[model samples]
Target: MPSVVKWSHYALLAGFSAVLPVAAYAQTEVEAEAEPEAATTVTDERVVLEADIVYENSADNTIIAEGNVEALHQGRVLRADRLIYDRTTERARASGNVIITEADGSQQFAEEVDVGPDLTDGYAIGYSARLPGDATVAAKSAIRRSDGINALEHVVYTACPLCEEDTTPTWSIRARRAVLDEESQMISYRDAVIEIGGVPVFYLPYLSHPDPNSERRSGLLMPNAGLSSTLGAFYKQPYYWAVSDHSDITISPMVMQNVNPLLGVDFRKRFYSGAVKFETSFTHEADFDSDGETFGEETFRGHLYGNGLFAISPEWKWGFGVETQTDDLYDRRYDISGQGDKRGLYSNQPRRLLSQVFVTGQGDSYYTDAALLNFQGLRGEDDAARLPLVSPLAYADKYWDLGAYGFASVTASTAILTREVGADSHRASLGGDWNTMKILPGGFTFEPFAELRGDYYMLDEDVSGKDSVARAVGNTGAKLAYPMVRPGTNVDLMLEPAVMAAWGFSNVNDPAIPVEDSLLYEFDESSLFEANGFGNFDLYEGDGKVSAGLTARALWKNGTEVSTTVGRRWRSRADPAFDVASNLDGKSSDWLASASLKMGKKLELSSRVRLDEKDLSLSRFDMRAATSFDWFRAVGQYYKIDERISPAGTSDEGIFLRGEIQFTDRYSVVFGQLRDISRNVNTRQEIGIAYTDDCSRFELLYNRSELRDRTLGPTESFQVRFSLLSLGNFGSDSFE
Candidate 1:
């Protein structure tokens, strides 16, 4: 039979429900939350009973209910064989198979339960009481709270159900007085004893984890240990700080008994506009344990890196980055990599600080960028092979619609370079070219092009009239090609013949401007139609140089491709030619050609060669090849140079090899080797391996040589990262 209560009683129930926030209930169960501690506290509040239930009044403010016993107050429901409510103390004692259902649908059952009026205080004296998740925490007594804050005395909490069969649990934490703060969303335990199954594991004064829904509750992170042959045994205790919803920081304090104290911190902040990231590591330790007396006190080593990007507008953006090092030996000592020069030829190094602020934008068919690069790391003692100095470079190009034909374009740029010598050199240029084509009915195309260029230069110091040169060039050419190719095993074939005649005027005396910015060319098709293969616009050749070239490109079955371009240049009249100041010159090369061939996703070969018609010697040769199999891949590249230059002033030959292999899903290895054939010496050989698991990533490396003479020995590193992405690693599903 359904029992009815007065409308006033309904108002009281509505008041209680309105005071509390609904806890998250399983989809099938109602989600309810405990009210603020003020109105309903552990020591206050009273339980309201309803349903066709019979109650017997007793002494000590106790009300005993039986037969479909149901107590409802503050959105919490409890049922049992018998119920004892102590009004004086606001505690409810339920016996005979007790089941206390929370507003969140999570329930607690025991042989006996002593709960407060609002279900904020009291305990369940029973065999065991499990949490919402598979985490079953059993103790002699379990205290129940409205906020899901359960205190289990003498408890054994484990996620593993079959204790006997699975003796080794995934992991568990046993503690005294575990407090689950429903408001803050954290489970904190005092005097906690963490264990794996039945084994007595580690002990900590306190421990905490995220509550049911919130996994990224920032707090004390886990500790890790690693052993390195160089650094001995080291331990790290990490602290995580959740500053806000958009920002977080992690500070790791590492202690190496064999060495000194080390501090590493990483900060990440995401704003509504953009993001900013930074990392810094510091270490103080003796050079070597045994040689401590010789080196005296401890050494200070550290590295700092940070960068950020800002989107000013939909099409405009800005970005800046900085990397600095305190000591060169920091890498070898700390097992961090800083090898080679402080700055790789491509690396931007700052002495005090380096920054680049640029606003860039691009549109269909045209683009432009202007950037200010500040390089404080450029020391006057650095060699040309080292990093470049801070300077300003700007380039803008636009394509124009030729009245009745193909297209016309104009490009202009300038640069001022301050070398390590503190000398300033400037180069400026403006150029324009036009291309027009008339297509025949059969698809043969007649294309003619002409370009005019002028150059000027100024230097801080010069000798023998080598400061400036000016030249004018005019070229005309036609391209003939047919797109149709025989089909079968062969998929594509393209052949084109090109001829050009150029007459230029130059003073023939100018200091060479090296191709510093364009050293390595990987994969780019922009070089096909350029007036000069070089990237800069400051130099040009003159004096009636006629050139002829043929291009052939083919694609075979299974995605195989081959392309080749061969051309020869002949000058009607010539005087003593300029020297090989930079490699991109045709003073003595009678024939220059480049070719590339790729075979079915496995192999790729490319070569560029220049021949000295007079000496019958190879002036320059660059070759590269790469191949990949199922589990392994390798690539090799070689460059050679030959010129009538003194030993002190000479070109270089080098070879580089890169390889990688995947051992398994969890592990992989990589290797890189660079050898300088010019000096008959191996520059570097590095091997590295990375291992990934649920908890974190571990990296091991063995490099014979690095950045320079710095040697990174067998070093092992471990990083335990915790993020929203890592929540899956917990593997805690099926909440009970």
Candidate 2:
């Protein structure tokens, strides 16, 4: 006769009796000692069964269970309305709503199943499985081989959710036959069809990919196709290679109908301490004229960019960056630097790409950096030969505690630059500053500071009558502040009056000391209290100055705050070393005013203005405001600068507005525009509509730009993007 058991037998009761030791009983029955039995008398380690109703049919050496039958074998559970087990053959058959749950928590459902001893090998009809990654597979018939191979026929697979209202998924794949290879974590599909919203969209003869549970694998990524006015029709196909656990690479080939194909490769590797990345692209294409016409010459155009950083110790690190291009217009002509109008008033159009290798160190009280830098000019007007290359630039700063109420700091920097324009120079400078503060009676505070700096330069082109020059400067200043604070139940207010007097003495100006680093000077509230307004060693304030300002701040209990500051500077005499365009060139500098307001977490506003003290006309003005609600957000920015203060000798005034409004839970519209107020034209504008859900997102966008360049002209285009959760993104051009 055979035995019957419940599913719990395999999990909790299979070896329960064996686990209890006989040695414990020997201690209490020493006088009745007996010889131990042979090991062959032990129990078999096969499946133990239990059920609500069980019967043994000795005629065939079989065990049959009916009415809530359950069985367990090798960490797997089987349940059915009726089950039969042949003990001699170690085989089982189940019928009527059969379910098998593996030790890994995966479940298989079938109306009928035939499984071997360990449940690893089985054949089932009406088979269905729920696997990891929220995936499900159903088939009319399934075969599970002992070698960990699963085969299914007429199968449907999907990861999307199923609701009672609609059984059709957002996306799914149907196949005539599929095989899952557990060892390689891959699934192969034959005669597969992809369906979206229950409608067939595409078909493939054969396809194979890593299972959804895989984190990394080599495969073809999503492809992109687009139409461009400059390039005609283009397509990009990208392939990703998972080189190793800590490294990967992607190679994308771009094909254009009218131009040569471009190949781009990106590589990345990570170590325990740092990471490195490199990207490069190349093409052999004909050059284009200013009017977007292809010319005679076929040129090799490419760009290489790379960066890496590693930690040498707890406080020291080293890194290098590479930025080189075959030609400046190559990127713009190919539409590679992302879509937008990059020539806006405050866009900081990157005319120069800098490459550098540096090592840096920082501690509690000191910091240091040393680097070698090279620059490549990308603009037609910039002469690459005139740009200086710094072989080595080293800087260090350290601070020392001067007991309870004072501190001292020293800074040193040196650089050697070379250029073809005969402006090569080498300079070294050191500076030391000390300050002490005291709190007087009546809520008054006073701080006095002093600084001494010395610089020595060697010039290759001595057009100013000297090949070498040395200069030293000394400054002393004192700051006084009086604060009044008033506290109320709902708000707190503070008002502070601050004043500073500073005196400077330095060597006479030497024009040969070329102004390289401090060419753009700005008089703003951030620099109002500095002893020397200049930020570099080449320029130093020649005389004395007095700076006065008033600051007010208010904070409310509702998490709202407001702050304002107004300041001005008065010099003893106008310094000729300072450029006339700099607001600090006169005895009385521009009036600086700044204010900010914040209302809770949703709104913020800030503005800064530089006014010509004589007529109160604005020399520079910048304002920004942002607000957000439950379903909407808005941001606005305005910037205006006088032509006299512009290094390029051009005035810039613009306003940028952006907003997003959500009409429903899953739909939203976003719009933005950049308008040149000075020219009364729109530089760029974009509008997009998007739909987003928990598992997918779709967006359609229209973009327009009016930026004109040598190789690139104004552009208008439309783009569409669709993203699926756990899948990749697909992008295409709708119009151009």
The TM-score leader among the candidates is: 2
At residue 508, candidate 1 shows an lDDT of: 38
- Model 1 per-residue lDDT tens digits across residues 1-736: 0000111111122222321221111110111143444333432345555435444355564455676666665777766677655556755555787665656554555687554455445555764543444344456665545655545566555544434555454445556666555567666667877554357657878776655345465776666665555566778877888888888899999877567778988899987767878778997765552211224566776877677777787776666665666654454466543332332113453333455555566666566666556554324354443444545666667888867977887776666666654445566667777888777787666666777665566655443234644445444444444444455554767777665554555443344544334434211123433434335443344455555677888887777888888776555454333334333344433466789988854988999876666765776788999888867788889998763422235777889998877799757676778887777666677667755433233345554442333233323233322211122222111101
Q: How many clashes in each structure?
A: 12, 5
Q: lDDT winner among the candidates?
A: 2
lDDT of 2: 0.74
Q: Give residue 639's lDDT in candidate 2 (0 to 100).
A: 99
Write down the lDDT of every candidate, Cα atoms only. 0.55, 0.74
Structural similarity to truth (TM-score) of each candidate: 0.61, 0.84
- Model 1 is weakest, by summed lDDT over 10 consecutive residues, at 1-10
- Model 1 lDDT, residue 702, Cα: 53
Kindly provide the TM-score of model 1 when superposed on the true structure, using C-alpha atoms: 0.61
lDDT of 2 by residue, 1-736 (tens): 0000011122111211111111112111222235334222232333445458776677997666778765566576667787766667766667788776667775667777666655556666787765444455677877767786767778786666566797787766788987766677566779988777789976979877665555677766767888776777889988888899999999999998778899999999999888988888998878874344688688888887777888999999888877777888777777665322221111122656777788899999999989888878888888888988988888999999988769999999998999887678899999999999889998799999999988898887555457888888878999999988999899999999999999999434577788877777666898888878876677788588999999999999988999999999999988777775567787988889999999954999999998878888888899999989879888999999888676667888999998888999989997889998887777799899977765556778887877776657777778777766555567843211
